[model samples]
Target: MKLVLEGIGHAFLGRAVFEKLDFSLAPGEVVALLGPSGCGKTTLLQIAAGLIDPLRGRIRRSYRRHAVVFQESRLLPWVTTRDNISYGLRVTGGKSTSHRQIAERRAREVGLHPNDLDKYPVELSGGMRQRAAVARALAVDPDVIFFDEPFTAVDVGLKRVLQDLVIAAAAREHFSALFVTHDLSEAVRVADRLVVLSEGGTGFVTNRRIDGRPGDRSDRAIFDMMEAWSRDPAFSELFDGERKGLP
Candidate 1:
């Protein structure tokens, strides 16, 4: 396994978020974590990424490098897109001259135009900012990446494009990922396996392997799988409010 969480539990301000959660990720695998709002999916991803220490658990990570793409772009507004993309390299101590070269290469890989590289985050579109965010995470050449609902704010078309970018990048780079999202269709499109958290963040509801490879499934197939899972008893909590017409 590339990462493992054993008996993990965490709380904030004396309010428990989760308890005794055991999860693991294999090399080059993408796992989508699903749950209702406030179920601690992001918290768990943060724990796995070592952003926060669990109050009770043991986390074992075999990979040497990792990066996270947050729900918001979270880029530094003061910096140009080129500098933002290469920020990881700077943190890791890369030479100044090489930062620009590496940042441009990563920007190109994520479909950012060269003209956009010199612009600050305030000057870019939401999609362009997200592209730069993804590029920033990739610039470090991480072995593992943590995604916290990274596409939820984008339009549907742009969301799919970003999803494809992630799938292609993961395939080409062989990086494992833990993607946190509430969207089932997005999960089917991106993950090799889907793991759901139980209501109230008590524990896992299910951890099931997806039928096909991330990029191999057709749109119809992905939709069908999502439709079927929406009716599954194990996934009821996730879709119950929608079915009941509750906000």
Candidate 2:
């Protein structure tokens, strides 16, 4: 399946975060939407998902079988980890001993502990919650997965596991995803192609294809783009903002 975006633009409160944007994803391709905070990365994702409409352009894609991992986990506070994943499968009418078994199996696959399955969100660490969120997204078996900085709060060790899990999932189900993140290293780790938002409130793509698996974060190609973009005024200003941190 091909996910297409043409002339896509968005704004909020009369302020434009992005304008005249165009991008797309093919089946099993993982693309990153990289931008500074408040630059409409998330807003653009909403436009892509049809959760919100763009202010000035059209979003064309086949929906009806898509899932999203928001910046926030948005898990049910009252539900256990196991139940959370199971419930999502239920929402998608995906039910079976096989589905629950697969969900639990995937929970383990994502590094969630067996003991943690029955625990509530309140008991889990920030990274754990994010893992549960990923698990829920997995339960849906979506053709398209929209990830909105899904691993922001995680630690490096945990982050690598989460990142690998996503790549693994994409490979397993052959699902295409639009992953939004500020970390260039992370984008390089998982993205088949990377799209950068410009200071002029526009964006364009960088790569047309990545290796079979994600490239190593330390790969020479990855460093070149990061080094060049580090001095980018728009990116620099974004770094100067409160969200400043190394990628």
Candidate 3:
């Protein structure tokens, strides 16, 4: 299965952010979408999620189910982390092998302890909150998972952990991903393919067939890719070593 983006285009509030944005994700492929701020990265992700309508172009996919992890945890403030993780499963009536008690099992796979199941969002750190969000999305057993900067506020160590978790899941579950992030380092560590978002969110291939090196995120090749893209007149001014938001 693959998600094909043919000439995908969009504008925000009368301002064009991108045009003719084309890309695709084959089954089990984790593709990272990287671009500078104001390039419409988030807008592209949202369009993929059906949260926003594209002003033009066509998106074709045959996936039966999908899920997303927004940059912010976006959890229900009132629920415990465990409840939050299992909430989507309950809502969708999801069932795996044992159908009856899969929610608890799913949370355990993502490293959430049974005890912390009762802790609410107010009690967890930013990283832990995002972890719960990840577990929730995975529990849905989606064919496509959209991760919109899942590691932003997370510390480096935890970012590695989360990246590994995502990679392992893709390997085991054969799920495809459209991961959006501004961190070039992250794109190298987790993606099988990379699409750089140029000015106004237009995407152009930067790196493909990455075959992620979970440990060598800082490799020279990764930096070289960033340097080459940054030197290109189209994207040179985008990064500028500046931080960008999920939007």
Candidate 4:
């Protein structure tokens, strides 16, 4: 396993978010963490990414390095797209010339135009900013990437485009990922396996493998799989009214 969480549990103030959660990510695998609002999906991702320490748990990360792509672009407004993409490299002590070279390469890989590299976040469209954010995460050459509902803000067409970029990048780079999202279709599209959290953040609902590889599934097949899951009793809570409100 690239990462493992054993008997994990956490709380805020006096309230518990989750208890005794066990999760793992294998090398080059993408696992979608799906749950309803306020079920602590983001909280679990943060713990897995080492952004926060769980109150009671042991986390073992065997990878060399990791990065995160947030729901918002979270770009530095003061910096140009090029600089934003290269920021991680610079922080890790890369030289100026090499940083520029690598940043441009990653930018192009994420479909950002050469001209757009010089523009600040405010000048680019929402989808373009997200592209830059993804480019930034990829620039670090991480062995693991944590995605926190990264595509929820974009329109449907652009969302698919960005999701494809993620699928292609994961296939080519062979990086493991823990993707947190409420959208079942997006999870079905990007992950090799699915793990669901129960409402109220008590524990897991289910953990199961998808039928096919991430990029190999056809649109019709994806729709059919989702339809089947929707009718499944295990997935009933996902579509219930309880999934709404809070978080």
Candidate 5:
């Protein structure tokens, strides 16, 4: 399955955010949208998810189902973790018993204890809540998942763990994803390809294919490549003469 955005453009508060933008995501392929702040990364994700229509664009989706994990966990406060996880499944007409089982299994896969599934979101730690959100998204077996800087609120250790979890989940589930982030290393660690937006957000600056699987990249290797890319003209030109450095 694939999602394609053609000639996309959007605006907010009477100001243009992006224009004439184009991008795509192939089946089982993880792509990271890396760009400066306010360059409309999240806007693109929203457009791709069909949450909002672009001012001018055509979006095409081959997948039957998709999901999004935002920066916040967005768990329903009144529901138990398991219930929250199964909400989508139920909405999509899953059988109660089967959805519960899937929710429990997904919770465990995302590093949440099975016993914790009955607790409310307020009872869990931030990382655990994020895990529950991930579990919720995974329970529906979506063909694609859109992640909008989902790990930004977590600690470094937890961030690394969650990153690994996302990569593993994508590999195992065979779902494509669009990970939007300003952090270059995080993008490098989690994505199979990297696409940078032009400074004006009018078009793509470059599209780079990542060399290896996330599991195959060591810390030193990631650092070296990130550093090298920071120096690459193709990477640097994305800034369009701005003194701001790649994060």
Candidate 6:
């Protein structure tokens, strides 16, 4: 499966967010979309997911199935954790033991305990809710999954665990991803390629292919790589005060 965005342009209230931007996501590849806060990363994800149409671009998608995990968990309060995780299946008209089994397996993979599946979203912690959201997305067996800083609300330890879970899932399922994040460390750890947006969200600053397996890299190794890239002359603008620099 593949996704392509050609000559994409968007604006809000006469303020141009981005214009004439071209991007693509190849099959089985994970691309991290990095930018400063409010730089239209979320907007880009929305457009790519077909939730909104770009005023000046055409989007082409070859994937038969796609799913998105927003910043918020957005689980239903009235449903059990397992039910919330299976929401995608229900929406797509998949009602069977097979779908239920997939939901249960995905929930477990995301670190939700077996006992926790019967509880409501309000009954789970913030991280648990986020895990359920991810499980729900994975349950749909999408060929591409878009994530919009879904780990920002979790604590550091849980954040890393969730990142590892996503990496493992992506590898096992061979699905592609467009991960929108401001955290350079997180981006480095999860992406096969990294692309940074300009400060005004008008264009791309850089597109770098990372070597080695991001999912297998140690945190210290990823941090060192991030540090080196931040100091590189080509990426200097990405670390300037106009944008959220690497940590």
Model 1 residue 68 CA deviation in Å: 0.5
Instruction: State TM-scores per candidate.
Output: 0.96, 0.84, 0.86, 0.97, 0.94, 0.94
lDDT of 1 by residue, 149-177 (tens): 99999999999999999999999999999
lDDT of each: 0.93, 0.77, 0.78, 0.93, 0.88, 0.88
lDDT of 3 at 123: 87
Residue-wise C-alpha lDDT for candidate 2, range 1-247, written one tens digit per residue? 3677788777667777777887777777888887666667887788888889777776667645788998778889998888887776775564567666866987887789989998999999998888888888877778899999998877788888889889788877888899999787788789887776654475653334544467344567767866776676635654564356445
Candidate 2 yields a Cα-based lDDT of 0.77
Residue range 1-247, candidate 5, lDDT tens digits:
4999889999998788888887889999999988777778888899999999999989999989999999999999999999999999877785799988999899999999988999999999999999998998898899999999999899999999999999999989999999998778999999999998766756777899988897789899899988899888767754443446534
Cα displacement (angstroms), candidate 4, residue 108, comes to 0.8
Better of 1 and 5 by TM-score: 1
Which tens-of-lDDT digit does each residue in 96-121 have in candidate 4? 99999999999999999999999999
Model 4, runs deviating above 4 Å: 241-247
Task: Give the lowest summed-lDDT range of ten residues in model 6.
Answer: 237-246
How well does candidate 1 match the true structure in TM-score terms?
Answer: 0.96
Error of 1 at 40 (Å): 0.8
Please list the residue runs of candidate 2 whose C-alpha ends up more than 4 Å from where it truly belongs after superposition: 94-99, 205-212, 215-225, 228-247
- lDDT against true structure, model 6: 0.88
- RMSD to true structure for each model, in Å: 1.4, 3.2, 3.4, 1.7, 2.3, 2.2
Q: State in Å the error of residue 86, model 5.
A: 0.5
